[model samples]
Target: MTALPQMILTPLARYGWATHDAVDRDEGAVLRELGRIGEMLGARIAGRAGAIEETIRPQASDDAHPRSLSAQFGLNALPFHAELSHRPRPCRYLLLGCLNPGSSGAATMLLDWRTLDFTADELRLLESAPVLVRTGRRSFYSTLLSPDHAFLRYDPGCLEAVDARGRCALDLVRRRLGSGLSEVHHWRRGDILVIDNWRTLHGRAPSRPSSGRRLARMLIDA
Candidate 1:
């Protein structure tokens, strides 16, 4: 498989995110563009099996869950973290496009691991620390920062276990990577954002009571 062009890969590695405004807003055209990009990156665009592709919006039931938007801060919603971070072969990228920006407040935020300002000690701690993550009924262990590529597999939402040092390291990372280091993207119709899921953390802003936000999302893997 061919690798992504350096022109695209460079910014993705350095910033962890990129955006493009589409002149052709038709769903078919947008999808074709996405497929072209995915092919160049040697990735296949995927969605949840058995699910239909459509505009995504917040649900009232999402509020009932502690992890939902209603429970999170109005301005800064908790990030999705790494849903597939712990997997041996995790999703490599995420693509989200706005069909409607919505009258209700909703924006996407991204944090680049490369941009985090970590002290030498904190970095050392993160490199060596282990953490437990739980998804559904399954549990597994992984380091916050991988030794090989410094890849991060942190999901504050799914964190199940951590020791004192690990906890401290996580706290420091969260504190530093929060709103301060995040880049907020206010959606506009036809705006598409591509993210390096392995190297960045992403979240959404809280939606208003009657938000009209609609987005189409796809995961990509090589």
Candidate 2:
């Protein structure tokens, strides 16, 4: 049997992401490679309901507060947050690739949790405070810091809607994860990015309206 390509696990652990460039353009080949890598990581491909979402600009709507297709489809913009925050089984890893690079604004931004610098008081506060996350009709509560591993499960926009304490915590986290440490990735054809969802927050920059950018996304669970 042919040997599978070895997975690169270091960058994702240390920096919260591992990027692979010039991936095979064939979709079937790419999926197979991703599946193999996912298996090596002891993670299964996430199911359809929460996996393989396509982020694209929407057609113009006449509503007073016109929302972009991304927002309409529940795809989040540049807010610092973990994916599937409201779910019992949040994705352990996220795989994102560019299918079509739009004419404007579809860059993805990532923040490494390891790089965030918080004061002792702020850390204590984050560890103690509970954040309420609500998506559509579903709702749940979680702390920013995991009691066991101190991993973060943050979604600032959700917190901003719920209460003052949560908002303050979000602000503190945002301040710590300033522009300096945040990494912005402009997608090219055949590029794939794997992120450790529990250790990183991912979002996108505002894309131009009707720009044809399309991204293929998948989630994995360990």
Question: What stretches of model 1 exceed 4 Å from their correct place?
Answer: 1-10, 45-55, 61-76, 86-89
Global lDDT for candidate 1?
A: 0.68
Alpha-carbon local distance difference test for all models: 0.68, 0.65
List model 2 lDDT by residue over 59-138, tens digit each.
Answer: 33342112222334333355667776656556788877666777874688898776776767877777767677655566
lDDT of candidate model 2 versus the reference: 0.65
Worst lDDT 10-window in candidate 2: 63-72
TM-score, predicted candidate 2 vs. hidden true structure: 0.78
Candidate 1 clashes: the total is: 0
Which window of ten consecutive residues has the lowest lDDT sum in model 1? Answer: 45-54
